[model samples]
Target: MQKIVILDYGMGNLHSVASALQKVAPGDEVVLATTPEQAEGADRLIVPGVGAIRDCMEGFIRPGFVPLLNRCIETGMPVLGICVGMQIMMARSEENNGVDCLDIFPQPVKFFGTDLKENGERLKVPHMGWNQVQQKIDHPMWRDIENGSRFYFVHSYYVPAENNDALAGETEYGVRIAAAVARENIFSTQFHPEKSADAGLQLLKNFVDWNGQY
Candidate 1:
């Protein structure tokens, strides 16, 4: 049986992410993994987060999950990171006074401060609500999800990866944010698929079928 493990470092909405995965792939085992052994044994892995980047990084290192995560990526294990989980994959974040990150993407997460504006109007800092995701490159995870599909987003900071090829999707909120990023065996999203409606569900379904290929 295929097992999909959601790493539990006590910083994410674990139940909701698990529930969403179960709904999409009921036949597959969806389990929350609190230990490194459980996480490393999964057929697929998900790193979901909701909180400050500093706390998330601390949670990862506190439980000795950093090495396990690195091993998973090195072994070509299919992994997905959501929200702040995605941000920490970068080299560093400007949140909480410049915290160092995992350096998976060699990018930096930038905060959309209160001064951000669109057409002379100040945009909200937390860029919350539904926004359209413009597909930047063709990817298997984007299989059934159409271009310009709307997804739910709630974030104050965003990743602007240096490599454009790694950017799978982009969205606008006074600035173009890296909505989704993908490399071999790994895919990350700034938007919450669990919170998004139909489009979000479809993307999750695609992830279930993906085999870490482009």
Candidate 2:
């Protein structure tokens, strides 16, 4: 059986994410990876978070996390970044501690502007609630999603990868943000799959079926 690991930081909807995975992939063992080596050994990894970017990096401090993550990607271990977890994959985030990220995505994380309005009101800083996502094209990562599907999203910042083509799906929160992104085995999404119902579960299922760099 392919073991699936979820990177557990001090904060995040870890339980929900883990539950969703096992419910979708009953044969896959879902483990919480606190160190680099454990992460490196997994067949698929899920990094899910709902906190700030700075705190998230603390989980990587177990030493060699960055390289382990890179090696996992190189070896084809499917890695999924959820919400803030997805933001940290970029070069840098415009948040408080704004430290360098895993550098998997070339773009920087940016915040929403107060002047922007979706339906005539100032757009909220932390975009919340259920939103619709438009599937851009057919990609294995997004194997079973329809053109427009609603997913639960909660975030203030969004990632804009240098290569626009890497975006698998997009959502509007005053402006369109990369809601879904995939680069080989490395895949990410701004929405919370655990909260997305069937569509989200299917996405997680696809990641479970993903044969990473291997």
Candidate 3:
């Protein structure tokens, strides 16, 4: 059975995330790893959060977080970050106090502070609602998922476009936001696919079943 370690940093929607996966991965062990050591041997690593970037990074500095997360991902364990968890996947975040992220992606996270969308209006602060996601690349995380499907989103910051080939999906709010990203054994999502009902469940199942096919 595959082992999924849900990173428990005390600020994420850990219960909901684990519950969502349990629906699809019936027999798979879903463990809430509060320490890095607890997550070291996980077959899959889930970084689930919904808070400021600064505090999130501080959480990683705790005892076993850094080494444990690094070991798991570097050893080819599939890692998936959700919501703000996804933003931390980037190298840096211009959000609160200029946070230094885990550097999973070289790009930095930017807030829709002043950038206006296609409508020429300053996009709302937090783009919270159901948005359509277009599949930009074929990835295991999105296997069997149809393109142009709607996913739930609630955030003010987003990842800018980088290497186009690394993009798996995109969502448009004020402007396009990185909805899903995949490169090698790492993957992440800005939308709460877990809160998206059927579409969300499928996504959880897909991640649970994913064998890292880069």
- Please write out the lDDT profile of model 1 over residues 60-115, one tens digit for every residue: 88877888888888988889999988998988999999999999987789988879
Q: Model 2 Cα RMSD, Å?
A: 2.1
Candidate 2's C-alpha runs over 4 A off are 161-163
> How far does residue 7 in candidate 2 sit from its true spot (Å)?
1.0
For model 2, the local distance difference test gives: 0.80
TM-score of each: 0.97, 0.91, 0.93
Q: Write the per-residue lDDT of candidate 2 for residues 1-214, one digit (tens) a residue.
A: 8888888766676889999998998987889877766665577877777777787776664455677777777877788989988888888888875677777888788877567797888876788888888887677767777778899998888876335767888878887788988888888899999999999999898888766532
Clashes of each: 0, 6, 0
Q: In candidate 3, what are the lDDT values of residues 46-94, reduced to their tens digit? A: 8888888888888866756767767766778788889888887789998
| Worst-scoring 10-residue span by lDDT in model 1 | 159-168
Residue 190 lDDT (model 2): 92
Q: Alpha-carbon error at 158 in model 2, in Å?
A: 1.0
The best-first sequence of candidates by TM-score reads 1, 3, 2
Predicted structure with the largest TM-score when compared to the true one: 1
Clashes of 3: 0
